[model samples]
Target: MATPVSGLCSLKNKVALVTGASSGIGADVARLFASYGCRLALTGRNMEALQQVTDKCVERGLDKDEILMIQADFEVESDVRKTAEQTIQKFNQIDVLINNAGVYLNDSVENVILENFDRVFVVNVRAPLLLTHLLAPYLIKTKGTVVNVSSIVGRVSMRGLLTYSMSKSAMDHMTRCIADGLCFD
Candidate 1:
């Protein structure tokens, strides 16, 4: 019986923190991780959506207790911190950090403003950095991995996604730096 999302790595019983887990890629990742038997800590701004995702995980055989749902908005730095604290409080150890939360503004340099740019950066770049920082100790101890969900927009410029593109580019760099800094061998 082969599963849909095959894995070269073993994920059974591992703990994963997936941001933006209410929808899109985040929700899909949560479902896949649950299928692999990874304990899940999912964060998103919408509880109703989060619960729907949770239901899918439950359908995948994760006990309701095996999953922790956090209603968080990455625009708030404190929410980012609280996400880490809450996940750690529940799971004690985190084996995977999925920085998938993000905000996108359809604006070009011509119309871009600090408020919108900051919102994009805070969620796309800063949230991942802060979560990695807060969970560094546990990640180090467990030799865990960080998956920053970045888009091609980061590398290829688009007219209406000026701020989003820049933030994702920064995210690309952040992922590389984190991988290097966390190298144990």
Candidate 2:
């Protein structure tokens, strides 16, 4: 029998690891997921901002123990690995991984420096790929979902954002490749 959409979408007891949860879309996603009864492992570079989001989630009905806030800079490989390890250690399993951390460097093609371009790619594209690789085994074990947030600029390029746009475009391509590979498995 086909399950009802409500039953299918219910996040009760699911463990979600949301990156960039300190602000904006990531913060909002963490709040909504918590409201749906999912245990959360929130990560970002800003400890204060992440704590505020965690407080908001607690107010939304999740228990204090149901949330784990890890302050991590995605650009750092050790931080990325530690974040994943801590989440797995806390929850034992991860049912959802939201890769929403990204960097935006506003520079035209001529003005963009190699360092700035590398930073954008490292945070926006490489970090997500690394996280996905690290968490793929858990995700496959539980048939969990991985959501990689990309920008509209990836589809339609914008002026003065060459590096940012390029990074997001790589992210979009990586998403497509992962989706295709998943279908075969």
Off by over 4 Å in 1: 1-9
- Model 2 lDDT per residue over 1-185, tens place: 12334643478899999999999999998988877888999999999999999999998789999999999998898999999999999999998999999998889968879998888898999889999999999998888899999999999978998999988899999999998886323
User: Model 1 Cα displacement at 43 (Å)?
Assistant: 0.3
Q: Can you give the lDDT of residue 25 in candidate 1?
A: 99
Which candidate number maximizes lDDT? Answer: 1
Could you tell me which 10 consecutive residues in candidate 2 have the lowest summed lDDT?
A: 1-10
Report clash pairs, candidate 1.
none
Per-model clash counts, in order, read 0, 0
